[model samples]
Target: MEFVERRSGISLWRQIADQIRIAISNGEFDESGALPGELALARRFEVNRHTVRSAIASLAREGVLRVEQGRGTFIARHTKLQYPIGRRTRFSAGLAGQIKSRGGFLKSHVTEAATGHVSRALELEPGAPVLRLERVSSADGVPVSRGISWFDAERFPDFANRYESRKSITAVLNSYDIEDYVRISTRISAHHADPATLDDLKLSPGAITLRTEAVNAEVAGRRLEYSHTFFAADRIELDIDHQAGTALP
Candidate 1:
């Protein structure tokens, strides 16, 4: 309330916007919850309707709010569910543990010799056999992520075929005697989606996404799998936990 700054160097609209952002970050507005009405905010800030509108527009463009016609402006609330970066977990398994509601569909499977990135990740020759599985996961029917996973074909010749009907990649790995594997390293970054990614994830062209790249190895530290997953920033939040003594070996 009373967000306007008459003598500050910052513009009135910008000051209003900054305060609203601070409120959102501080949990003033619940995650994924509705925001105050424009007239209500205008009254509280002692500003004209146009001033409040401008502040809302700035926040919307910055991915802080989503304006739904007829419904109202809502806080872009997303909870970043952390997937353990130090332990090997299947996509469904990890997500199930983090998010109470989850769903997914396997998209495709490709079997070929590992090349370039895959080979380098697995520490094998460029032509080493590998199986790739593509999947799209969702929460409450909203697309959350697109994933591609690669496994050593020599170690799991049936990986591609068996995984087609399986929901848990860890189960498939277990069938191949890879009873346990741990995450070696996880890299995270933010980027906009390409045309293909946009189509697969059903995201707007300008939407932001979080990319996670992870490598997994047996207990002995022999790398066996690598995966890349892209998450829709608007729909889902990612959480990461790094407890002491659980770090990658």
Candidate 2:
């Protein structure tokens, strides 16, 4: 049993809930398919029954746990969409067949000066001009992810307008004679949703988000796009696919 961290600045119930979620993900309770009783959890975490119950209630609200009148709390059976990340990753194509529909329009775009990691990822000099795009993606009519991408403004002067017209990033790039590109690198992590993301994802305060920082470039190895994305953790799962034809032709 992992003792709940004391004076960790986080609420006792929230810490307990996070631990429980991790335990469920690890299949620690799969044999029983239900969590230990409130009393047992209370003792294990050195907290009161009320604290343990609060944790359970939060998980239940998140649809991670199901509670019955007499039966114990059990893990909810959820079918999260599997999103593939590989050398070539695309939104709609990655979720094909798994979803009845997949598409989202650009929310906004602007030309801004590149700074910090954005400059490094795209191999642009610091303070160079870049076209930034803010977009959201959906699966089966439900919001799944939000993304922000940056491209060299000088190189793609009309990216925003072209994307708006084509409604496809690939098409917009293709018009520039960029026939093929591949993902150069990607970094993944998890964090709690920020206020804006919570509103966009329609999730409560404690909802989790899966974050990815990725860069894509042409076959000639010229970096073209640098992006930051966040997926609703409970609704989508990311998988690494190294096979050929990872992206639609």
Candidate 3:
């Protein structure tokens, strides 16, 4: 730890977080090793213990450090578990609930629909309308995956507008009278992150990601949504479960 400039205009916590991230990347704190105590870091950085903890929290969310309540903060081990999507759920609700259930954090929002593979995946003709959304789900402050989801434009005419001010995509669909739907099918595959994907995911080159392509439809099979999500394979393991007589709920 080192002292940050008093008048640097950057928040103390942010400065601490930046330095800590740099330290980790530079191997100053060995990978999978324990970080300095909060008290010690505060003393060195000349900030409050709370500030140091906040910094630590930020790093942890980014998958840099692992903090255990009783055991202290350690360099995060390379381990990630993909929570199983065993049932039908809305994307916002599903990830938010799953993160809470397993001590993770989820940040999601909407973005502009860009032309490319996303349009095709959503089965929209070239330059057709589409909903663009992004999700960052993290465990212990480390980002496990960053997802960009797309939906057909014609069917969701105001999708982008609705999501701009709201966080719940499901609620937006509900507003359109799409009360319920089923996931028609999901296709899962693995590949190295493309340049854009890697940048958004904050990953090194060649990092593996699990891509899930899914189409959702109403009871009558009218297509409602289409999505492709890429999850960091290092931080999550997708668990597929099967049992007789259990429809996706």
Candidate 4:
């Protein structure tokens, strides 16, 4: 049996849809890969048949399930893209062979004094100047991840402007004569999508997100960037490279 929260700030049908999506991803269905009938699903979810139908319809629209008029609903061939996270975690390089087209665009940018978290992550003094950049990354024309990054404003005062033209963080850093940096650490968590994340990632209500908090540093271990990235759970999965070499550039 499956459980759906009644007062979790999410609609019942949407919650059911989310659960069904997750089940499909996990291959919970039988060998035929077809979902159970509406009545069975309703019973499992403790909802009405109409609500179950609504959930199925939503999944069908999202290309997660195929519904034939006479045939039952079956899982679609929408495999999640695997994204590698390693010491040298370049966005474009991470998804190179997995996706034909990849892009990152700045949504917003601001320069402000670093807060405690940002200051500590970047090893800057309290209230040190920093550039905050909001960006969205797309794979095959579909938005897959949203990221917020902070860089030392004193070192990269023109970072936002450079990124607007470069469109690649690596390229922008190169222009500043900082040729190489590596991921120092990454912390990951899962959560329900917020309104802003839903809008940015084009995800439905109650969608799950994989959030990664990362810090990048130069060859000498000087912090260069701090970022928080949210990835659509259905669209991509993180592949952690535990054997990634940390050789300095």
Full ranking by TM-score: 4, 2, 1, 3
The runs of at least 3 residues in candidate 4 whose Cα sits more than 4 Å from the true structure, single-residue gaps closed, are 7-10, 245-249
Local accuracy of candidate 2 as per-residue lDDT tens digits, 1-249: 478888888888888988887887787885658888899899999999999998889778767889987998989878999999988788878888898987787888999999988999999999999999988888877889988999999999999999989988889999999999998788888998888787676665667899999989998989999998999988899997867433322
The backbone clash count of each candidate, in order, is 7, 0, 11, 0
Candidate 1, 86-161: lDDT as tens digits:
3645566666765667778788887888889889889989998888888888866667789998988887877866
As for TM-score, the candidate ahead, 2 or 3, is 2
Can you tell me which runs of candidate 2 are displaced by over 4 Å?
30-32, 37-39, 69-72, 243-249
Model 4 Cα lDDT, one tens digit per residue, 164-195: 99999899989988899999889889998888
- Lowest summed lDDT across 10 adjacent residues in model 1 is found at 240-249
Better of 1 and 3 by lDDT: 1
Model 3 scores worst on lDDT over the 10 consecutive residues at: 240-249
The residue-level lDDT of candidate 1 at 71 comes to 95
Each candidate's root-mean-square deviation in Å?
Answer: 7.0, 3.5, 10.9, 2.8
Output the lDDT of residue 77, model 1: 60
Best by lDDT: 4
Q: Which structure among the candidates has the greatest TM-score?
A: 4
Query: Residue 55, candidate 4: how far off, in angstroms?
Result: 2.8
**Each prediction's TM-score against the native?**
0.68, 0.85, 0.54, 0.91
